[model samples]
Target: MSDAHTADEGRAPRRVLVVMAHPDDVDYGAAGTVARWTAAGHDVRYCVVTDGDAGAEDPETDRAALAATRRGEQRDAAAVVGVKDVTFLGYPDGRVETGLALRRDVARVIRRCRPDLVLTHSPDRDLVHVKASHPDHRAVGSAVLDAVYPDARNPCAFPELLHQDGLAAWTVPEVWVRGGPVTNHHVDVTDTFHLKMTAIRAHVSQGGQSAEFEETMRARLAALARDAGLPDGRLCEAYLRIDTR
Candidate 1:
């Protein structure tokens, strides 16, 4: 991971696409890193697989309205991290499945974006922290990985994309999996941590309005920085970097 980071440290800005399950997933996992990239002049886009309609605990909540609200919230959140492009796939929040449909849809975005790097959740479950391994997250991860490989790059995998939408095959060079059990890459995000919090705070409907949530996130990031051997007071975001090239 360090070698990879060093290799690309001072390279020209590359396009980055973040694919996530819900509105706030990016803010929770990669907002700080995203801030750094944007500040460095990288192009960034977001493809949210779901609208997070099932996020609320209230049984009587209007799912459709909630979904709309979440989409708006996600757009606002992305703005905080200097990302202006956001695409919502409108998949059911909690019922996302790793299927051909999802793979193809994600592939479409890949071709459209032609991103050099794709950031997503971990397909593998984390038994240590079950709460973080949401089923939808894993599903999106698996689908996106598949899309980045055979589906998006292979011309025959999704022929309709080329024939109908004129989206050509795109091969993503690398992928960074967030919230995975194993992490080999660490981004020193101390400078952008506040932006991360501000992005998360945009998801007010999902408890991001709470000051306690911000403090908790701060503590967690600090702990991660320590684990990554960073000096005290620094903050970081960790990822399992996979080379797809």
Candidate 2:
């Protein structure tokens, strides 16, 4: 719940790693902020936890085809935000688990990326609204937090990551969890909202083009920024800061 923002002005720009459960999760939530970060010359990497095989509408689409299509879409979306390094763990689309195996995998990425800040789905999900609180999102978010904490920082927690993966222990100073009830910080992304929209649009195979859907998405982000006292036309992304130190 810390409001302490990391000042990137004086120090060398640090890498920012964003982890999500699905292909379009970052586009729907964190793309704007990611655009801002990349524009600021920060290195940004995306780690997608799922293959998103269940995201297509055409039941005739095979799992392999769906996964390949989603990977391409995610790459296109990531490119929109200037994110070139994207990793997909290939976990089942809707059945991510917050277990040691998953935690260790996340920790391996954190250690390899050595990010100063990590972003993932909000832990305190909206229970009343099932659409916004997907179980996979919750699972990935929780696993990322665990990986960022004692797991990633403590050498003993995931020693294999260090030995086999050439990843050293890394302690991310801050974490930003999006799409939750307990928002404590907002980033002004008006300049990048278009890029965000483009990123979201790249997931066309996932049915992101409906007029109603677009309007609702824009309105929600606008309302979120407004509620945080940001100016009009200043689109924003909100987060709950989890400071490890």
Give the best candidate by lDDT. Answer: 1
Model 2 C-alpha lDDT per residue in residues 1-245, reported as the tens digit of each score: 22422224345677999999999999988888888788778999999999899886777889898899999999999999999999999899888989999999999889889999999987667866566579999999899999998899998897788788778888899998987767788777777778988899999787777778767878887887788776676567788877886
Cα lDDT for residue 141, model 1? 92
Q: Where is model 2 more than 4 Å wrong at Cα?
A: 1-11, 210-212
lDDT measured at residue 38 in model 2 versus the true structure, 0 to 100: 85
Q: Score candidate 1 by TM-score against the native.
A: 0.96
The whole-model C-alpha lDDT of candidate 2 against the native structure comes to: 0.85
State the weakest 10-residue window (summed lDDT) of model 1: 1-10
- For each candidate, the alpha-carbon lDDT, in order, equals 0.90, 0.85
lDDT of 1 by residue, 135-237 (tens): 9999999999999988999999879999999999999999999887898888888889889999998998897767788788889988888888878998888
